[model samples]
Target: MILLLLLLLPAPALSAPGRTRATIPGDVPVVVEANHLLRKGEGTLVASGAVLVTRGNDTLRAHQAWYDPRSGELRAEGGETEARVMARVDEGEGPLAIEAGQVTRLGSGRLRASGAVHLTRGQDTLQAHEAEYDPASGEVQAWGGESRARVTARLAGETPLTVEAGRVTRVAAGVVRAFEGVVVTSDEETLRAEQAEYDPQGGELTATGAVTLEAPQGRVQGERVVYNLRTRVIAGGEVAAAVPAPDPEADVTYHLRGQSIRGAWKGEPGSGLPQEIVLERGRFTTCESPRPHFSVDAREIVLRPGQRVVGKGVGVSLFGTRLLTLPRIAVDLSGEKDAPGLFPRLSLGQPDTVGLRSDWRGTLPLGGAASGYAVLSARHLFRIGAGIDRFGSVPFGLRAGYKEEASSRFVSGLTLTVLPAFTFYLPAAWSPDGPLQVGLERMPPSARLYSGDIEGERWAPGRRYRLIASGCAGRFSEHPTEVTANRLSFSGALEVRPFGVLPRVQVGGALRGRVGYYSTGTRYGVVSPELSLYWEPSRRDRLRLDWRHQIARGTTPFFFDRIDAERSLVLEWRNRTPRRALALKAELDADNGGLYAWEIGYSRRLECLQPGIVLSQRGGDFGIGFTLEIPGLSTGF
Candidate 1:
């Protein structure tokens, strides 16, 4: 019975130079084949002459191999004239293939390969002199040994990448770690560091130790950097970068240094430079001088290329000297030749009555929905005036001190706007020269409502008519003690452009009627008709004439509601171009001296500067003003 069982067994094991199968008690069965096979000490098998070994999903082929069934370990070596030993292991993350001069499988399920090792899985490849592979986790680690062969890998993802380092390790399916002189290259950016961790699946590369990233747009260097391959956003600490101009035609670059930085690219994801970047404890400048001609240092800075730069807790320096410190500041970089951003302005002039005067205007963002502007003037006549305006949903404006030859304690107004042409204003004024005491003076709170025209397109095509209705109620006075009346008034104005034949010439007319009732039992009615002729001879020149006639049927005690002018005519000529502007205006009014008043103003716009002059004559009183403005820095308030 024993002899028959022996004969029934496979003949290959018994035959020399054939295949043998070794079954372990708790492991997968091992199969070995070669031209020559021999039994060594303690269940150890030696195979030579084109040895092939298979255990589970792992397959290895070499010229000679040694397998110990007791320990479940295998080692293979290549022959002198033959190719190196090669092994392949099938795992969850594709098949791992390794080629080396010698390969060893330890009992702990780890494979060690040396001597010009080359590993591949899917589209990823690794080259090193020594490497270790974990079949269960599909992790491959390569390092330089005595031969000092650097490890290199090529990863094929959305962006093809190449990594070279002294040591490289595959931590996960798409995660790689590199150390010691690491360089990662892709189409969009190149990165260098002493150590880096890259996850191609997540499109993130984190590099540390004097890291540097260079892209087509600019370059960044820092102690550490984490870059998104997909978004092309770079974030790091102790960062310094040179960002190119957002305008492609411009050849300017900005330098930034910060404790920490985070930014993003604009326009399309892959193309274009960074549109916005933010830095903490940052210094930013466009000057390339070693010390920089001008720079801004701030607690926090936000840079929007080609638009503007905003800074908080900022200190501005010029020529290494600190010039100013501000809570917040914004600088515009739109490259507009004429319409510059808000800047502090100082002008010296002489008014009709006020002596030598100096005026200053500036704009400030009040944060949130409100931005505030102020105009302050000081006169030699011991009169100081200030006007402040806030723009937002509920705009508030205030003028204090003497203005227009009138001494005003304060004149303040608040406007409430409702959608679709409804506006209400709480108008109040208190003047020392008025009949009323120094208290709250309601200058007739008013409400204005309009329709039949688009808000910003009143002069656009298609709109031919507009209707405006306004009402006010309260005390009214043009001067102190001129009238003692509490007035309620309602007015309506209708404007129509009935002519459509001449596109370049616009002939429009408006009729306005007003009715008022006074608390002192005085009622008045007034009607006003106005005609306007506007001719645009060219894109840069226009001529306009306006004739207004007013008639009164009844009179009110309040001069504020009384219309004194029975007839008025105004003619204006304006010439405007990209580089210069000229304006001429003449007015004739009856019932108010019947004097013909005229004014002429001209301004020339240079690349970065503008100069203007205005001369006016009103009833023998002549006035003149000369102004010099920096186009990008003048606030023209």
Candidate 2:
């Protein structure tokens, strides 16, 4: 039985230790053992029992190793300790070594390692849970369940730099490829990604798939990110980051989803270079308010500190609600909260005893350096109809002025105003007295007037002292007529405050002179002057005293020389409770002479109520009135 004999016969004698079984044309020997053979013609070799092969500096070892001479590849299989191999050909003092439990060489200088592959070249070391390495091209790939690898290199200063990854591969001398939950941390920052590549020679790193960068300035999140360490530049896609400001009040958090984001370092220590951020197509939202108070969407946007932003196809919203949409929008980065001022107000109300009234006022900017501005306002009142009688009137007017700011003073443009009025009054026999008629008759029936005025004030450059001067002239009509009576008025005031004073001391005087000539042959002249002194010892206490004298003379029996004089003193005190939950104020007024009058009132305010309450007594006409007001609902006349 020839087959039995072939199986039982001893294998051909393998080459002895340190012996050559086959030699190449250049004296390059191929070695094998008793159970191993190198068949160049058959393109295969088999080795067993701690097999060892050498070619110059290249060495291979394994319990069992195989080679295909036709393909010029080698493989080893056995316990990793025995499967280790070193490959080099007089390149240097040391050779590159590859060790794994099982190694397969697939020609083309490529080797795949499974079960704890480790690569080491001099002081450089790479350990992968598993890997594939090509010595000829310096390409290595490692991946497996929960795979990870670490690489370390000693720099010129003997400082060791290390990199760790879940999966790693070397593509070239300075480039390494990594994937599947990768993280790279260097001396300056840390980066995480689903995939990434690093090149130490180029000083560049790129990442994708949920990439995130963490640095001292901020944290950046994006889909893709690339960073250049040498230039200190970082570029990203669909990035979002948090930037904090130096001022606590000026700090703002922004959300930006854009085409890309880039940052560079200024080279100066601790100085983050000003960033130039471009959003090709993106939007921004702020985290401030009852809702997101501000938001803008644009086709393109650029951001730089202290620079205005101009956006196209812009949409802006406040409090989470769209407020405006524009083809273009620009915003100043350094503008004050209320710098560009425009205020308009409208109100309607009915005082318990005064009937119904409405008022409107608004301010407009005139656009100039002189602080030119205009004000337009109007008011209407409808007296409650009683006993089949109704009375109502409307008054409207406009005033424009220019203001200039000087060293320590402000001057106002001369202003002119005209107001026409209409009214109805029943004879004294109609109604002796009623709540509605008590204070209504004091209003003029009808009037037309014109006036010119100049007002100027100077506030001490660094102190609380002020001086004011004002004057005006106008005409009035008791009834509609082609010609109307005229009036002249003037006033002056001065305020002084000593150092460490809580309130200023104010002294002022006013003068009014009127000369009227009617087309109906009626003439009258009147002059009135008032002197006043006011002192506020503190925010809660005040005192005022005034004296007025009036002289009226008429040219006809229908009129007469009427002389009236009055002197009054007033005192007020206000205080807030220690708890700050309640406030109280009291006032006393006394007048003597032709218009002798005395009044005392007190008011208490509570935070929960509309405002507060007042109780007053004046001579024999004492009464109590309460008022509740909301900004847009109250009317004052």
Candidate 3:
């Protein structure tokens, strides 16, 4: 039995060949089997036929075995079942299984397996032609067959990652290191490097030595890459990424060459546009040939796609010569000249005005969602503005300064032309709050005029039902409009989602109330109910309808206002395809039985710009406007 047991399971850690001391656990029941067994001493065993052994949490099986009492050596040979030598070690995690054509236990915490060597644990596996294991250190070193052997691991339910190299080793638990022509592939992304290290337990992966990664985004090459699964961040040094056009049909792709790249993302590297991406010592270009035709080199660059992209210490070069050098900006990379060099903006239908009726604008990138934009209006109308982050998504922001509309140049005064004011957003998740503005002489002339007015609002968080309450109180001008009015007004709205059915039909409504009073005497109060309906039959088509009503005193009014009797309706339709979008809007005022207004717009993407036209009839004036956009660039407010 001792000889048979030795053939099936090797002696515990201490019993291996060269150890000075062996601490064998007596609690483990060793079961052994064989056609024949011979024991020279407690350490000597020889067995043949159906040999198997079981040690605490480990087992070995073979058809034949030989043991030396002096050296404490064991040898297992194949027969039936290929008599394949197998080792199954359970170290808390299922088992670390090793199988090979031949197995040798050298007794001093050393083991060797040759021929079809394979190791497997859970969803992870390693295969090679030969391998070695150190029982004392629990390290596995493997060599490939005629072709390269590989390691496969599964992480976070994403996809199975496969790694291969000329040589592989597992010196520590849950950590694997591969050297020479190392390649790791996950989904469609492939990373190649001279060496790679993966730690499944730590959720960390890294590669070094001319690392190159290929994904849908394009191709990236760098000196090293370190990715942490917990942080969802991929960082690399000396990186160059070629990101192709998001649309597969587009012929252009941007090559982002940088000293380093660090970003947080969920996609399999490159398939999904990335946000919060930072690049240092970077240059961006569209050329893919051996040499770039043009490039924008910058000291530092930050990008939050669909939000903003900023490059600082920038130089735009044509071929090799620097064409434009600027400190920073939202540089347009659409491959078209920016409407070709300072074209004057001319506007008609304006009364004789001293300043250019509109403003010429330019923006320079400073940081995330923050930029310095200078509007070149007349000296009197020119203004500079900046804001930090996006209040809804990121943290911190400056709404805007209280800039009053410009009166004519002759009559314009600091008090009447502009008010000194600013607004800040409070840090919050989900809802926008902590917004308050104070304007001194910067009041809206159309609102009966106000001075020292402060307004704020709060909202209840939820989509099933949304509620917003807002109020404003300030001094009304002792002027004509509302002279006797020391004004205070409050408004609140509660919206509910009535249904969440499929087919993408949405139904919603809001009950709103408004109340206003003047210290002098006049007051107005009303409650209105609004209904909205939206239909999205497909990704490209949508329709929406909105209905609202307003009510005032009746012939014989009651003390409290009831639901508005006058009705108003607005209907809109939108259809969008790959390159074109069409929209129509119509409004009807049933209170007075009149048409409020209607507008139609069509936009199409063109080679150089997305030109759009708008025609509208409101009140009694007919207006037409044209829009031009450089594709793949930021366009509006």
Model 2 lDDT-worst window of ten:
1-10
Estimate TM-scores for all models: 0.54, 0.44, 0.54
- Clashes counted in candidate 3 amount to 8
At residue 428, give the lDDT of candidate 3. Answer: 33
Count clashing pairs, candidate 1: 0
* Candidates, ranked, lDDT: 1, 3, 2
What does candidate 1's lDDT look like per residue over 194-312, in tens digits? 99998777889999999988876678899999988777677899999877766554445777899999888433565654468889999988755668766789999888877777888
The candidate 1 region of ten consecutive residues with least summed lDDT is 1-10
Every candidate's CA RMSD? 13.4, 19.4, 11.9
Relative to the true structure, how large is the alpha-carbon lDDT of every model?
A: 0.64, 0.45, 0.56
Question: Which candidate number has the best lDDT?
Answer: 1
lDDT of 3 by residue, 354-403 (tens): 22222112332453344322334333355333334444433222222222
Per residue, candidate 2 scores C-alpha lDDT tens digits across 365-460 of 342111112222222222110111112222222221111010110111111122321112222112234432211111111111112111212233
> Where does model 2 exceed 4 Å of error?
1-53, 60-73, 76-108, 121-125, 145-166, 199-202, 246-252, 263-272, 288-291, 305-314, 324-637
